[model samples]
Target: MAPGTAERIARLIAPLRVKPGSRVDLARDFDPRYKGPLKKKDSAELLAVGVTLLAEYQQRLAAQDTYGVLLCLQALDAGGKDGTIRHVMSGVNPQGVKVSSFKVPSAEELGHDYLWRYAARLPARGDIAIFNRSHYEEVLVVRVHAEVLDRQRLPGDVRTADIWERRYREINAWERYLTDNGFRVVKVFLNLSKEEQRTRFMKRIDLPERNWKFSAADVRERRHWDEYQIAFSEMLSATSTKWAPWYVVPADRKWFARICTAAVLAHTLTGIDPQYPTVSDKARKDLLTARRELEAEAPKGAAADPYAARHRSAGG
Candidate 1:
């Protein structure tokens, strides 16, 4: 993490959280004085701070071999989950990061249990896993269009009213399970207003390159926007636990939303207080012995070429 790289990263992510014509007041939620673009200096400063904290988090994650999760960017269409991931995590160590994007389930997927893939996708110890859109879909998409669930033929004992409640209880217990086992869960709902989504939809239609983003089905879903919101709000209220809290991000102003998200994430990671594992004295002595032997037998050209070095990475 360079002096200002974190800030620049923050600027890049800022646009993903909120766009113009947003129904929510994101800037005001963070600070009413915040206006348009995040200046280079400010963004740079933010990134510097953000990266330092993430480095600490990465160290702690590795040392403790703890798993952490960033879950459920639950929002309407164009809520900026992709953007948030791209920008907010730019400062993180990619080696320990895994991202999963959940979409419409295939026939085979429908046949198995809903949690099947989710369980397999869980990050291993010492890793961070991000869910672009997650299992919450079972609640959101299923509730809005029962047709989707009808295909799966849910358990006969599952009642209509009890289904969602069961999920919420399972979600909270699951989060607590993770925490007790050394996992952290952070759920964020990108709360964008209908007005903002419409503006972005129109942008996709009007802009030549962005035209591909528009879909006729998206307009159809917009009609049920109220239903989705109620489901989302209810989900947030019911599942916002002490172990895993849900943050309500204002999705009106993209920059403000990005900053606030960064702030919150930074806050969470910092709370983990990760520290790099210290090398043992025995290991240090062994390294010194190896270094002495290497130095004694080393040739001038023993060092590798820079160009060849570029192709191979430490991860390999």
Candidate 2:
């Protein structure tokens, strides 16, 4: 029922989820390359099933118009976040889904609280919003680089040494509030290995079409890989609450990662179990009246049902 192939796949990847209040040591706790029994060959089929299920659930979610889903994807450069989003969500109606990629904050964004921009882009009722890089960036990148924090322009008194801890508490509380108010939060951390990251960087440079995706800034950021890892571990440990636990997807293999991410989403939507709105007695009566009027408008002695002749002609 999850981002996995079937119930079996979902159970297989359950260990990837970070439990509440559990300490995360990315290097020690999770394997960036672990795929369990799943192979690359099965990814397409598994992903296809997941996508179809997602489309059905998405339609129900929209028709019900009762809840919104927010999928927060946090990853380092070359972590396959973009690819995962593209492939996993390919089947959903474009209008029912939104993909927001958060980059370096603009002057206007910096002027407001770090979460201000994110809060504005939250999913509306009955839709899904995917945050490529989310509010967690404040804890990940900002904590990694002290200068980034200074740029936030917080009051001096608010910039205590325990700012990260305080922010973690604030974020947890904010997410809790969102859950209480009908938005379900699904957080995923794409755990890409450093070696694989280097390989991807080389491929981006080696392929002419992908050269534009490569950036000097990406290389600079790679230098702080260890720092980012530490930041990610801490963030996962502190913020993986019962309401919105983190799914640490093994991201070294793009296909596997996509499958896991899709399964996670499918699983969440399953838990939500959104249903189509039931027609009330009054509405049903009105529908019957409308059907009669439409039938009466047909030509005299002609079939009131447009498809009736077609079905007879086709020997249906």
Candidate 3:
């Protein structure tokens, strides 16, 4: 990798990372429309480079078959999570990538433990799995709307005052366990501003093609913006651990957000340092023998007049 490329990637990611144990105040700590030091054109160019590098790294990761990457994206409605995934991850080979979008859980999912539905979607070794919205919803949306918990039918004690804190701890421990077991978790929160969200909502409402995306419930949820903000801030402060820190990317500028996401992923995959597996001496020897046999079977004089006999037989 070029040093300049590495530096660009570092700059793109540095401002966004919420270090472990660091308190996050959302309003004070992050900007929803930040574009860093790069101009729009420069940011676009850098993102192209970063996306190419990410594709290369993903290929090596798949070939090594020794590590798994889990990318978790969390955001409010119309926050561009889908756009980030589409544009940033477009270069990667689909066979090596799996994307699971978590929505309202089915009755069967609600019957299991909160984490059970997510556990089954984890990436296998040599693969990258992306979660459009992930397990964090348990703490974010569920925390903001306590009534959702009533559906869980948990014992009163289990859903007591300390439940949020307990869930945060469990999430941190779960992420630590995943890191210890060869999975690298990259979590991103697309920090979209309320004003930007309203603009997007209007576009969804007025545009014929996007009408299907507009929902009355989205407007209903926007009424709780402050509550969601508080929930998100608390979640970030509590769960951004050493093994799996969160990058709160500014989402108002869709292009810049996409670039930030691509840069973070490129940087993370580079740190993993995946490579093609080395061949053992015995395997190398077998390859050599196979090569020799293939070479030995080459037709004599083919190089000088490869298709001469065929042409003559056809009376050309």
Candidate 4:
């Protein structure tokens, strides 16, 4: 049976409250109506809306100075998190955008609370903060590698089961607090099939430079794929809420993944406009005069670079 467009859109907005230590199916509820190989035209069409929404969101961030957008992106290695961020957010102004790739926490970071670095990196008023992998890792990685807790030195009171649930409750409450304090959260779990991941892993092995990216951990993690999926599904169901929704993006096709992600981001951000700052009437008059003065000095008859040459230089 065919799912209607309305039903598909509803899925996009639906909140997921995935539980801690459990997997969730945040994969796309893709419909044929919106599924197609992403060609240049399709990408451009998606970008048009993305650019506009980003501009609007930028304005709101600047004006409200209180509201922010916290976009959390998580996926297996090579799930295209970096690429998606690059392509989908290509049009966003660099000044208003901030990307944080949370790798292994530093020795100093280990000294403070788990969220210390995270709290420091939270988007300022009128900013968009992107977390490549977020505090969720404290749950995922810590659970997968129990030794990681040795570094955290958590209070003795936090038993394994109690700690996991506490962290889940803490995250939910934290997100709710942020939303109430003027922030919109978007969590995306890139859904890459095991077969697709195997293909990517093979590519890394076959290519010379890519060999460096392959690790024992990759092989190790594959062993736990089922557990991770179960964990992810539970996480989505427990954490997915109306205030901050989760988008399950199918990632078999990298290009399509970028398009769909950009679409969702644009959809969410369009409600708030991020406009270029306005100048006063007097400032505008002065700026216009300065522009006219500069234009007057333009050399009229000079030979310009050939279109082909310009195009070549610009394109490549």
* Most accurate candidate by lDDT: 2
As a whole number from 0 to 100, the lDDT of residue 50 in candidate 2 is 84
Choose 3 or 4, whichever is better by TM-score.
3
Query: What's the lDDT for candidate 4?
Result: 0.71
RMSD of each: 7.2, 2.4, 5.3, 7.2
For candidate 2, write residues 1-316 as lDDT tens digits.
3443457656966988999999999999999999988988888998898899999999999999999999999999999998899999999999999999998899999999889999999999999999999999999999989999989999999999999999999999999999999999999999999999999999999999999999999999999998998999999999999999899999998998999899899888988989999999999999999989988999998888778777997995
Deviation (Å) of 37 in candidate 3: 0.7
**Structural RMSD, model 3:** 5.3
Local lDDT at 165 for model 2:
96
lDDT of 4 by residue, 174-286 (tens): 88989898787878777788888899999999999989989978888899887776666666666767676677777777766676676566555654434456689999999
Q: Candidate 2 or 4, higher TM-score?
A: 2
Q: Tens digit of lDDT per residue, candidate 1, span 1-316?
A: 4465545544544433433223333333333223356563576565556656666676677677755656556668898878877876777778888899988888888889877667668777778888888878877888889898788878778757688888878877877888888777777777787778888999999999998878999999999987886786567657767677766766666655666566656656656756666789999999988777766675676643444455675546
Residue pairs that clash (backbone atoms under 3 angstroms), model 1: 6-47, 7-43, 7-44, 7-47, 18-253, 18-254, 60-274
Q: Tell me the TM-score of model 3.
A: 0.92
Q: Any idea what lDDT model 2 has?
A: 0.92
Model 1: lDDT to the true structure: 0.70
lDDT of each: 0.70, 0.92, 0.90, 0.71
1-316: candidate 3 lDDT, tens digit per residue: 7767766677779889998889899989999988888778687676788789989999999999999999999999999988899999889999999999998888998899999999999999999999999999999888888788888778876878899999999999999999999999989999999999999999999999999999999999999999999999999999988789899999999989898889888888998989999999999999989877766776885533335666887896
Off by over 4 Å in 2: 1-6, 299-303, 307-316
What is residue 239's positional error in candidate 1, in angstroms? 0.3
lDDT (Cα, 0-100) at 267 in candidate 4? 52
